[model samples]
Target chain A: MTMRSVGDGKAEFYELLPGREHVTVIEPRANPFRLDLRELWNYRDLVLLLVRRDFVAQYKQTILGPAWHIIQPLLTTLMFTIVFGKIARLPTDGLPPFLFYMAGTVIWTYFANVFTATTGTFAHNAHIFGKVYFPRLVMPLATLVSRLIAFAIQFAVFLGILAYFAVTDAAVQPNLWVLLTPVLLMMMAAIGLGGGLIVAAFTTRYRDLVVLVSFGVQLLMFATPIIYPLSSLPARWQFWASLNPIAPVVEAFRYAYLGQGTLSVGMLLLSALVVVLILSAGVVLFNTAERTFVDTV
Target chain B: MPRPVIRIENLSKYYRLGAIGSHTLREDVNRWAARLRGRPDPMPRTGAAEPETREGGGIWALKNLDLEVGAGEILGIIGPNGAGKSTLLKVLSRITAPTEGRVTMRGRVGSLLEVGTGFHPELTGRENIYLNGAILGMKTREVDRKLEAIVAFAETSQVLDTPVKRYSSGMTLRLAFAVAAHLEPEILIFDEVLAVGDRAFQDKCLDKIQDLARSGRTVLFVTHNMGPALDLCSRGIVLAAGQCAYDGTMNDAVRHYQGCAVGGRRQTR
Candidate 1:
């Protein structure tokens, strides 16, 4: 069958059977492939409302409120500077340890928060999923967008720090490569969302996997360049480390903003390739899971 | 003549039962391993044969039922508890899939299984109006255009901007049914949702359903209330023991329904 919108006074199209028999050349519309994008578009205000709700609910009624946005990363940067920069004497390529870790923390926070929030999507919203039938993907996408607000708040703080250091002759300067920040942000979001979707799909069948995902995501922070730069790892371990996907994102951020680390163009391209594969697999699995998840969840 | 809006053929669904925790893992693995050895696996232990479909039974809720709902037809399905009315509507709404058969449906399917399916409690009523409308397959502009009417219909104009969490259950139900009424989907499925609202609101909901019927939409209703069933449906089906016991005029179905409730039951076909 063919269906069309009634946007104009002209006839909308809907063909079935004999008159359309020769239309086998066209692709068959499947379960949600025939999804009405117009319907989702119409719900844009709802999407905005969800995004706003997520942003506020995270910090609302808290003692510290949204100030935790800056404080969390500041504390994280201090801890990293103590452990990796002091105890391990990790090289930051002569950049101050605080400056080095803060960049990575702000960028890493975006990915980590998005991943953790999205991974529990089905389990967290079991009540909503069972009742409603909007585009299921909208939940995760709205979460990712909401998290960008937190990232933006932290980034402004990072810029303030950068400005303070530059004026005080603390050896900070905005580099030309900083223009690559948006690309790095996109890569981080893609990997986080793609990985989170895979976890969400698996968690619906095996509930234990949800706990593992939370634990694994935390463990992954140390595996990535969160606490230290990629330079600290040995040459043999570097190749394997770059394969972690988030490693390239962190490395790229450090290279662009801090100007004290190496960013391998080839490795970043490889990370993009891996993200594309992961996201494609995620979409297929998420689509298949949504069919029976209502029953299983 | 309009084509059939919703069609189902020989639809069946099955579910497996097992222990809930890690202790069952060993048995599940043993079952698989025994199957690979080309031998009959162990069967359920004594009393493990409880049917899964009947709220806690292990039998089919619906067995090989064929149904076709024409465009603009208001079909009311009446059945005893466990007669598979809700299960059938769930399948039609694409909330779940049938195990052994297929359903071919044209146009969108909107189901109001309960109030506030996708409503976020922290969001205002205005926000949920759009969110629920989108879930029901209405476009954004359609919701925007009808927003005033929806709030007005529920008499909730004053509370539109208030968080839904603060609304009473009756107020929530009123707003929810109002959104459903305004959705105007090609096929609308209602599963005892009308039973929740107050008497006055139920009348309003019933009147809206009657209006929708006149608007050339197909509606599938499951209810025990015979008056509204007969008022809204052109035809009805009475289900007993997972099969259709009677399918004919609304009055006949109601009569069969009444007889089953009062007299010692007749043998179900």
Candidate 2:
């Protein structure tokens, strides 16, 4: 029998060998803790392609197309201004109600989008996951990046509003803390992604969590001060309210954009600590779930 | 001696029967209590069983299977439905985990467990090409390099930009197969999806698979059809009741499967 070598450095032969053993043994990993960074790095192009697929496929047949991205937030802000500002006569901390609610709506919208998309990672992509093998983390990670792209488009609308208010009226002022805008956005994303991954992990077997997610997010909005200012909370409840991870992010965003709301370095640091804890826990749970979610999902 | 590119040693996958959340918390607590006392499981009948016969509470999709695929070999895997064929492919592709045992694979694996796995009907044929290619682990540059050949092979260049939902099912299958075959990973797995296409396309796929094996790529093919198994593979394995019943030359394995199908004694090699 003649022996030939393959490109992967293994030898091939015409005759079957009786005693040869397999070089790679695949067993259930005792601990699915090791993240395959190299494999993920190799599949980075796929992540980019998936992001493009999501962004493009979302607006493919719609008449409004990408306009819906702007329209959704614009309409929501208008609704909030009428209900919370005009009807309820809520305080906007000396900032115009439209811009305040707009700022809060834009940031909250981004977090909500990322949370829902990432949380549905396994359920939505089960078909793809069942067929192929790549870094499973790519899907959730791609959702984060693509939603960030969507947020960028919406952020452009916010910038247009900011510029309009800056030149025409003195009601809204851009402070130096505007430099912290990117940091605040990153924290929102981390918290949403971290929370979404935990939920996605649980949803494989207990599908009740899937139904609870949308309902829970709506309830969470009431808890976060999106329609109202954090300063309006009674003095006793202020400390406990800041404990909500999203509370500090919305507060910081409003403070940066309008120079009106509270922006404390201490609270921001505390929010960052909460994000780190949730994100690490999310990563661990998500990694373990990805290995076997295909079967259960 | 040449080393085996794929090795499966005593691999097994156990699955719970029926719905995933069928048990109540009370039943779970009782089961745990029974186990704590070093006694037999309270509901042994509902416990895990081998996937082939489905006798117990749960089923073992695969049970203590030992297999090895040599480098550049085309190994045909054949069995009846629920014979652990799909389960084995899922385990090999790492889509699911094995409950017991281990499998080691030396190179990158490309699996076509189902055709058009990530294809979105709303996307155009051209766009689905890129998306599906990426899902199959091809980089943008790689897909770009193979774009012309893939489009040409599928014969869908005229309607390339049209949404795939408008295309006939055959067109979709052709495009999916063309992309999958052209990616050229080190190991390729196909799971009975070839039957979707016409006879001519099926023959074309078989020809491509033969060409792939000839070009020094390992292939694990699961199929009910024996013609391709005998024609393309040098070796084959027949799985029955979640275990390998026969493993030898392609012709012998096919004969063994035929015998079993006709209620004859299962001949082992």
Candidate 3:
């Protein structure tokens, strides 16, 4: 590498964005934190742009445009209401069946979408990965960002439905617990991204994991609180089910918005701890994997 | 003079070609169990030592290589395909790691291993320049300021707003090379990307590289074409069978490379 601080009008030609520095730490050796932070800051705008691309591409050429966001969950909620609520006679803890299932679906869809997309970071983008030198973590980060946008749109639809129900029915009252909604959302994103990192790290070495990841995520949805409320499960089963990381996230989400489900502070704290542990381990594994994955990938 | 911008010490990269699936796991486990029992790990068999020459099982992509590229020196790496030229660049660019060595780069390095790397098919050429530039570690404002020059250099100013997937192959290379070369990175590395476009475009790329070199940017040029390497490089390094066979002045290195090719032809005959 060479350094030329020439003043031949080259530097003057470009408008230096405020608060942005051309930071290149020429290290004697590679460091993890420095590399990741440098990449994140340098590519902040591109990250936003890629997120926009994912958001727009999903709607392009579709007749519904952004309405599909609401339509998808609405249709799924209706199907679950009929199939599980009426046919299977599944318990909904005395809460309205559509509201209960839609709440869980809203949380589960966000986690599942981010997880499935991020797990295939290596295999799906091998062509791009093979030729570029950016931080490998950027791809997964981009996936999380894009999924957040979709989740926001979907969540808006859920709110619109909830608001309609509140207006027509005297039993429903807008609750103050809605303020905790952002906290629940962060927990869901963390778990999804952390789990994705673990799967993506392993998939680089094992191609079988790629197919298994999709299947595994689908299987995990049943084990999670997606279809049934926590009160429906027996006491012993509830304890075990709550240990699943997604359980607390889903319950917290429902409790915050609908004010009808259970949210154990113990379980939520445990979920946060699990997310941190998984994210730390994933970062270590992903960093090590990034150093040598080009060969295997 | 300034310290060596790139210092490579005895770099080596080894690869294993095990049987399909996880067939080698059983033997690897057995070796681990043996080692636990105070015995040698016998799974390595014959190819474990000096792995570069093993035919059916493993091969080294680089071997015990020592090199130092000084700041502001334009060094060309010339070798035939599978001679580990790309692998070397991959290691240097931090896209891959060496098996048994370390490298210290003194400044920012940029590489264009292929035309249109990381170019989103759905993104317009203008957006792709920012995307690719950021992927190459350039800030958005830098790309914005150089936007016009990049489009002009690529000769696709009219199509800057058009999606890259709509562009021809020649146009793709034009836009990609323009963004990479004009990004003003401290070290610029090219891997045969100049082969894109017509003869005139190729010459234009060579001239651009020459200008970059004249401006005192360190460049590591990888190409099979000796003509361009000889014309642009102050020094040349030749690799053969995963090892550096020659490293000296361009004239001497080119002669050595030619001699090896003739010798290889004779051996084949």
Candidate 4:
């Protein structure tokens, strides 16, 4: 905070007093991995406003408005139930097909919503990013929250279906692990955000990556145990499936809420490690990209 | 008489030519290697070399230039196209990082680089006011305090709830400017977008700038329009070829600017 004086006799010692003045230094290159949570906290109002804008603006002229959030996932669940359960004969591990698919749909839809929205961060918001300065992470983070709200709505609908199955069938088990729902949701967010951010960062320089993103995310969902339970996989292949971090999350979620999927603490820990790794890498890539993407983008 | 609010040292930014995807795999590896081994860049895009990883091929938006702005000074930056006028403002506001040098600024820096940035067409006038304010770094509490003033200044209180897409471009610009005007940062940076609205609104913007200076806040303004810029700025700096060409009183800088434009000589001091 050493400041240069104007060289007049009036220069005073109170110039650099704490809290009275704040200083910012912009350099050509910086440690791109530095995560400034304090600055993000200071701009929390902006995050809330951005989330509100995204949520409220999209439904402005629509007839059904927010109901679309629930409808889209419900229809997707119906499609999955028909195609995967009825046509493909995928096993649902004794739980009802509709309930099983809806369980996975609520969480995966949240993931896809956050992922696809943030994957265009640099391209879509280049104008705002070029003109003003805020922690660029705020854009994607706000998308996560807004989509989380949509997920909440969809989850409530899923619960209604769960309640139907819980009374009619004794197979649906509500276990103590259900209490870990918040933690599971957070893990999924990290995966979506991390994967999205990495793609977004690359898309700034090579926009072709944008084309690959949605396709890749679709492939990712199928690779997970969404359409088919992890138990359906053979012994050798189950270990391979464990490599996909989201597999354990979907399985754990099913085990907690529906009471019938295998989840070892070791498997969960491995997946958590993968999620953290992806998220950190994404943040680092984002830090570097945000600083100079305006120029290249 | 007061401490300088902004201090820039050897500030320079180099942009790659046809910059997208120009970093061939070999070039990237070379750059990464150079950075890791503490060696200079394998290729120098501009003739000037950087301390770390010099760029491969690009133009320097700003060069080895140093400047200082004292507290409460309305320093005008006047330059031609590609003369680093907007680049300077972008660097000052932290919109983009410099490639060679650094800038340190005291107190909050709010930029009106472009008004109506991040304005959702689907959002109403009132909603956009809050959204744009937050985008420009105003806290919700601050925007709340100034909501009435903003509505009055923009004169769109009647259609506050109507979506902005329905508003005329002029009305939209007014609302955006109104929100930007109330940012009240310790330091303000702006581009010449103030010429957007009618003459009356232009005068209001100028008056608001003057009021900001009178309130002891620093202002950094960039404009291609010399007449209005001369009227508003107390001091002026003319830039050419990414370097400062002249720094003096507003009137003198405009004169020197004309001379430099005609002769194209390096008369920096």
Candidate 5:
């Protein structure tokens, strides 16, 4: 029998037969927590292609195509202006309600898209996932990247509105804190991926959870400080709302540009800590689920 | 002999077919406990289709399977329906996890389990070449290098920019096979993908598969087309009820399968 190592070294050399060395061992997942970074890195091009496919799938064969991205937020902001601004008499802290709601919508849309898209990672992609082998995480990671295209489009529109308000009334003051844009986006991505993976891991078995997700996202929107200013809430409610993790994210995003909402270093730090914990936990569950999700799904 | 590229030992994959209903919180707790104790699945039964052979309320798709293949061997796996052929391929491709045992391979493996996987009918043929190529484990630069070749080979140069939905099924398969042909994995597995195209396209695919095998790559394929299967493979495996019924030359394996079909379950017993 001949025994020799291939390449620099055999990471896992199995000699099941004489003179035969096996490099990859496929067995039941023993340790799913270890990040399979090498496998994921090799398939990085697949992730990019998947993202490109998403952009094409969105626009292909549709008459409106990219127009929908622009129109979606514009229409939603218009409704919020009418409903919350006029009918409900929600205070925008002296800033124009149109600009205020658009800001919230812009940030919220990115978060919601990332959250909802990753939530269906298992069930929606079961067909392809069952047939081929790529890092299953590639699907969700692509969603995180592809949704950025829509978010960028809407972000430009938000900046346009901010420029108008900054020049016209000076009520919406643009501060150096606006530099927090990328950081705020990262925070949302973390929570979205973390929360979505947790829910996706369970939704495979329960499935009823899948039904409640969209509705739950709406409830979460209400729970956050989206429709109302944190100052408008009662003191006790405001304290609870500040701990929402996303509350400070939304607050910081608005305060960075408008310079009027409540912003706190302690609260922001606490929220960041919570988001990190949720994301770490999400990664563990998501990794575990992807191993054998096909059999169950 | 060529060095072995794949080795499997004591491989088993059990499925809970009808017991998806017992998926309540209590069952979840039971399964978790069993796993905690390093025990086999607590569920019973071993088949979804063979209701007559229900073991312990679970279905063992591939039970205690042991297989190995040397580099450059063209293995043809011929089996009856539900004989766990696809399950074996899926396990080898790492598409799903095994319930028991281990499978080891020395080289990068690619599976053509289906043509045009992740193909959006909305996307044009030119764009889909990149998407399909990536899914099949090709790099972006690799696809770029072979773009014109793929287009010309598939005879899809005229409709390269047209959405795949507009193409006839034959054109779609040709384009898909073109991408599949260009994939350069060390180990390639196929599942009935070649028999779908027309005679001309099928011959073209057979030639490509032959070329792949000739170039020191191990190719394992599952097919029901006996004539082509026998012609393409010298060594064949006949699977019956998730077990290897016969392993030998393609001629003998087909004869064994045909004989078993006429003899029924009594022969295996």
Candidate 6:
């Protein structure tokens, strides 16, 4: 039908027919945590494109390219080895000191990178977010995926060092628990994503949280069993350490690959519960914040 | 009668005056407490009140807006600055939520609120096409199909592989516009993007918008250039002081806008 005049002298109007799909109604979100899985699935390609953009844009104009990914973690591990393992005389629970720190650093770097990137989702992306409309979660989700690519590269460097120690040193041995590496990585991602989303949501209105997050993450690293094994702590302290969701994942990762740290099903379950709670809460808050964050951010 | 592609009912958007929102947690809590105590909000009103009546406080960017667009209607939105044109588009595109009321759309909406919206300077033009296309909700395959047309329309074939940072402002705008033009959504919203580029490119954009309308896709266009608005749109809406001042045929709306611009009395519908 084309535009035409009606008998009433007003423009002819039309009513929607029933059963035609593709209707989109814009209203206030009824449920804050209601995830539009279909929308996210439809935007999967955008997610991949953003992942590519993040990965490429990060190293553009850099001298070393993706080598910087490996170099960053390697350098950090070196400093930790010198300060914590060498000078401070920290014990690695009989495992090789270099390998011990390497394992922790690689996993922690992945978590920290993902957490930091996701935390900046609103502030860092205010430009794009202001001018366009995409599922806001895509930005943070893409950050997580892109950081995983960097993590993969760094993990390979860690594996190379682990391999060197496995061959050259008699004390270094990886058990079947090494197979739980994927699970450990997933936990790290969940915790980072959840924690970052919570912080990102808060930073939308209260920007002071952004500064807090930057330093808070660094301080949090010390509290986790990253530089020290959980076994080295007293029994009472170990129980408290396990309460930190990241502690078990880090401990399990080391216990899996290096076979040095303590691993308990009960602690793993508790960590999983914390992950679920944080992630659900974060998603709810993030979804709510994203709706109106452009105005505030 | 054709069905309306879009319907907006009593939409209102209230924005705080100076700051974005609550500046601190303490302030937010105080505001929340005020709401609980059933007291008036402490924020000042800060939007265009009435055509010549100036008041300062928290402004309602859009207030009690009710509108509808029939499928295939190329509706032009003409308004002065601070008239809520962009705010209406933002609400229609779902970029921002309305403080009151609701909007319903019968199809997917593609908005080009600004050119080069998500274009990264470091990315090559070709890469940005895919990235911008995806950001506009186009599938990769869709972008693939339109890649040749987009490059030709933009006339950036030579610099397709070069980073966007090196491109001139005109070239970047053309490329960004080309990608947006090819999005092929059922409903399209554009806000002053044609203000860029040379005259020839502006003509091409108007022609493209006309083509999109002829193909039965609805379009909500916001622009200050009344010539194009009258030339391209069958229907026009004039927004004044965050409210719809005139809604009629393009000719009448242009007259109403001209009258308003010239300090004549507003003719409200």
**lDDT of each candidate versus the true structure:** 0.75, 0.84, 0.77, 0.85, 0.85, 0.85
Give lDDT: candidate 1, residue B172: 95
Window of ten residues with lowest summed lDDT in model 3 chain B:
B18-27
Q: After superposition, how far is residue A104 of candidate 4 from its true place, in Å?
A: 1.3
Over 4 Å off, model 6: A1-20, B19-22, B25-57, B264-269
Provide chain B TM-scores across all predictions: 0.84, 0.86, 0.85, 0.85, 0.86, 0.85
List DockQ for all candidates: 0.31, 0.46, 0.29, 0.53, 0.48, 0.50
Each candidate's fnat, in order? 0.24, 0.65, 0.31, 0.76, 0.70, 0.73
Q: For residues B87-168, what per-residue lDDT tens digits would candidate 6 score against the true structure?
A: 9998887788777887777667899998998899999999999999999999899999999999999999999999999999
User: Lowest-lDDT window of 10 residues in candidate 4 chain A?
Assistant: A1-10
Name the TM-score of candidate 3.
0.88
Identify the CAPRI category of the predicted complex in candidate 1.
acceptable
lDDT of 3 at A170: 54
Give a tens-digit lDDT track for model 5, residues A1-297. Answer: 011235433333443444533366787755756777766887899998899889988887699999899999999999999999999999988889998898889899898889999899998999999898887889999999999989999989889988988899878897988888898899999899999999999887777778889999999999988888888898998899999999999998999988879888789899889999998888889878887888887
- CA RMSD per model (angstroms): 5.3, 5.6, 5.5, 4.7, 5.1, 5.6
Better of 3 and 5 by TM-score: 5
Better of 1 and 2 by lDDT: 2
Query: By lDDT, is 3 or 5 better?
Result: 5
A75-191 in candidate 4: lDDT tens per residue? 999999999999998999988999899999888888888889889989889989999998889999999999899989999988888988998989998789999899899999999
Q: What is the TM-score of chain A, computed separately for every candidate?
A: 0.86, 0.90, 0.86, 0.94, 0.92, 0.92
Where model 2 places Cα greater than 4 Å from the true spot, the runs are: A1-25, B19-55, B264-269
Model 5 residue A221 CA deviation in Å: 0.2
Clashing pairs in 6: B44-B57, B44-B58, B45-B57, B45-B58, B46-B57, B46-B58, B46-B59, B47-B59
For all the models shown, what interface RMSD does each have? 6.5, 5.5, 6.1, 2.9, 3.9, 3.9
lDDT of 5 at A159: 90
Which docking band does candidate 4 fall into?
medium
